[model samples]
Structure formats: C-alpha cells, structure tokens
Target: MYFRLEDKESYKSQEIGNLIRAYNRSKREEAESEPLNLYVEDEKGNLLAGLIAETFGNWLEIEYLFVKEELRGQGIGSKLLQQAETEAKNRNCRFAFVNTYQFQAPDFYKRHGYKEVFALQDYPYIGQRYYYQKNL
Candidate 1:
C-alpha cells in the first residue's frame, strides 16, 4: 500500500520514534543487556556498512544489515550474509532467522540458501512480510 508523500513521512517518523523510545526504556530496565555485534570492512578506511545479529532462544536473528546503496549489486550483501551465517553456526544456533517487508531482503536470503518459513500479507504495512531461516 502506498500513501501520499506526507502520510508516508508521518508513518516513517512515528515508527522510528517508537523504536527510540522502546530502546531507551529497555536500556533502563536492563543495565547490561547484550548489545548487537557488527562486522564490516571499510571502503576507504573511513566509511563502512555491515551486519548485526541478535540471539533469542536457539536462533540468531539477522537483526539489521546494510551495504551502502552505492555498493549494492557488487556482492557486498552476499559477503555480509555469509559472515552472519558463519557467526550463527559458531554460536551453536540451530537456525538463523530474519524478517523483511515486501521488496526487502527475502530474495537475498533465498539466494544465500535460506528458505521462506513464513509469509504474511499486509504485514507491518500493506506489504508482504517474509521470514526466512537456515538450519545450521
């Protein structure tokens, strides 16, 4: 579902705001929560983008991942994904999971040997939501 530009901006900001508030609350609740670990390589020793994973039960979730837009289509996403999967295995997680909205990383995960474990229509917004997993 697409909305007018103004509405889109409003929705985006609202979502981000909620995340910030929740993060702050969690920080106060648990002073020593495990922070996500990220891995990346610098392009010019100054700038870089990477991936992070979070643990929950027997699964490691690919919490966030990015390879600068300019660096897309250059195998960066693949390398980052490979590294994340390796990290998952090292942690003894039986599976790795990630969710993405429509037009997001579902295709990327599929190419990297993950299988679609769940798909929901109109999720988060009016787009499909995909959850993928790879058994380790």
Candidate 2:
C-alpha cells in the first residue's frame, strides 16, 4: 500500500467521503441526509446572506453561514439562522451543531442560544475553533 495526499477538490477525496458516508448508511438505517439551505436576496435577486446546512437522523449540521460584509450587523445573519433552525425543527431535528473560528461568529451563535461545547486552541495557527450546539 502507498500513501499520498490528494488535493481537497480531487475526485479521490470526494470518493473517500462517499465511501465513508456509504459505510455510515450501512450501519444506520436513518443515516440519510437532507440539505437545508436558506438565502436572503434583494428585490433584484442579489444575495445578501445565505446558510448551508444538512439534516440527518435527529440532528442538523450547519456547514456555513455567510453575510455580505456591508450587510453585517443588520440582523440578516440572525434571520437566516432563525429560519434554518425553524426548518430543521420542522424536519424533526432535535439538535443542531456548528463550528466556527475565533475570528468568525462565535458570539453570534451564542446570542442565538447555541452553547459552546468544545474549543480547540491554536488551531490552524494562532487561533481557536469553537463547536456549538443548540436544542431545537
């Protein structure tokens, strides 16, 4: 056997993810995943903010939440997060989890009632990574 690093976007990397997912599905019948995405756009269809997430079993995993820099502090991110949480609840999800960096929106998640469950310091450099969870 040989070992080599593949680019993040390489086909082998994606295939590896698929293999893991397949194995998980084989172990759990309820391992199917559903995307739960939300977006805020202007009248002209310009995107102002967006959220990307997924629901599996009884949990919602938030992948990303982004807001236009100019639109920050305007409550757009809060709205998107609220909407996503509502949708996750509707999908029968009981919990949601997300991770953010120290430079990202840790306080924002906390303000939305997410509790920081873990923190990894000196992660990816001289910063911290925080994992948060909320009960829906």
Candidate 3:
C-alpha cells in the first residue's frame, strides 16, 4: 500500500467526499442519527447566530455554533444554544456534546453547564482543543 499527501487549494475532491460518505453511512446504521440545524436572524433577515448538530442514539453532537461579531455578549449565543437543546430534548437526546478551542468559547460553554470531557494540547497551533458534554 502507498499513501501520499498533496495540497490542493480548491479542496474539492469527489473521491475524498465519497469515502467519507460511505463511512458515515455505516456509522448511521450502527446508531440512528438525525440532523438538526437552527439559526437566528434579525428583522432584516440577516443571520446572527446559529447551531448545527446531529442527534444520534441518546446524544446530540453540536458541530458548529456561530454568532456575528456585532451580536456577541448580547445573549444571542445563549438563546441559540437553548433552542437547540430544546429540540434535542424533543428528539429524546439525554446528553449533548461539542468541541471548542481554548481561544474560542470554552469558558462560555462551561458556563452553560458543559464539562470538559477531553482536552488536546497545542492542537492546530499553540492552543488547546476542548471537548465538552452536558446531561440534557
């Protein structure tokens, strides 16, 4: 077997995508998963904050959460998270998990009752990656 690493600016490769999709399908069969996407928009219909997650088995895995810069610290993030949690609960999820870097919103997630389950030091740079989970 031979393996090679090559860099591509476009990062759009159907071969890699199909490989991932096949693996994901196997995992989905192992445990049922449902996609959940939620977002907040202003009166003008501009996106402010949002959360993307998936509920699998009895757990919810949050893949992304983003808030516009101008809307930070105004409770928008919290509201978005709360809404996601509500939906997850409705789906019978008993726990929720997410990952955030040290320079990101680790503390914010902590404040929301998520405890650090794992930490990878100096990942992607001179920063840490934290995995957190909370009981629903």
Candidate 4:
C-alpha cells in the first residue's frame, strides 16, 4: 500500500469510474468462490495504508495500493512493496507487475530493478504511462 493513482480519462473520468464500479461488481460476484486478501496498516488505531492483490497462475496484479499522503517519500512505499514481492515469491510467483502513471514513481521501480514493459503517452495527462515487472 504505497502507490499513487493518477486519475486519467479526463472527460471520461466519470464514465470510466462507472465502468470500473461495474467491473468490480462483476468481480465481487465471484468473491465467495475465490480467494481474497486485504493487507492493511494502521496508526493510532486508524487504518491508513493497504494493498490488494489478485492472483492467477504464477502472477499477481496490484489491484489497489494506497499510502497516506503524510507518509509518502519516507521509504514506507518501498518497504511495503518489498513485502509484497516477498509474498509473491513465497506464493511461487515468477514475477511481479504494476501499472504506473508518468508522474508516478516509474524511476522508483527502476531503482528497485523493475523494468518498463510498456507505456502509453498523454493518458490522463501529458505524461507516459508505465507497466513494470521484475522477475523473481
């Protein structure tokens, strides 16, 4: 739970959001038949950080990641990610992947040995979108 979200889709934000909600509704419909994990962190008894992962075969998608704004840039994100990667490896994951916006920490992932596999430009804003993966 240490990544940021760049709400793209501009004029389509609301529409895209609706679509996401609908998509999530469908995914939730199968929740009872599938495994779900919610990892979270709290401070002063208040939940502040978390991550959600969906797994299939040997892969996991970081469906959601969040860290309180006041807690950013202090290595918390990196540590959380390290934990996620460790967990992925423990589960026999061959690699880990995440999507990031151009304004996000693409360089941060690079520093942690993740390589960019794809990118789309001018999405949500005037920046490069990124998909990164690191082999376990």
Best by lDDT: 2
Better of 1 and 2 by lDDT: 2
**Cα lDDT, model 3, residue 105:** 96
What is the Å distance of residue 26 in model 2 from its true position? 1.3
Candidate 1 local lDDT, residue 28: 61
Candidate 2, 1-136: lDDT as tens digits: 9989765688887898999988978887766689999988999999888999999888999999999999899899999999999999999999999999999999999999999999999998889999999999
Deviation (Å) of 51 in candidate 2? 0.8
Tell me the tens digit of each residue's lDDT in model 3 across 15-94. Answer: 77988989988776567789999889889998878899999989989999999888899998898889889998999999
TM-score of each: 0.66, 0.90, 0.82, 0.66
Candidate 3's TM-score: 0.82
- Assess each prediction's global lDDT (C-alpha) against the native: 0.74, 0.93, 0.90, 0.72
Clashing pairs in 4: none
Q: Candidate 4: list runs displaced more than 4 Å.
A: 1-40
Say what the RMSD of model 3 is.
Answer: 2.7
Residues 1-136 of candidate 4: C-alpha lDDT, one tens digit per residue: 6765676656567887999978987876432112225454666667666667755556666666667889887777777777877777777777777888866678878998888899999886777889988887
**lDDT, residue 51, model 3:** 90
Where's the lowest-lDDT run of ten residues in candidate 1? 28-37
lDDT of 2 at 81: 92
Model number with the top TM-score: 2
Tens-digit per-residue lDDT, 1-136, candidate 1: 8764563467778998999989887776432223346656676665467787776555778878887787788887887777666766666667788888778677788888789888998876788988888886
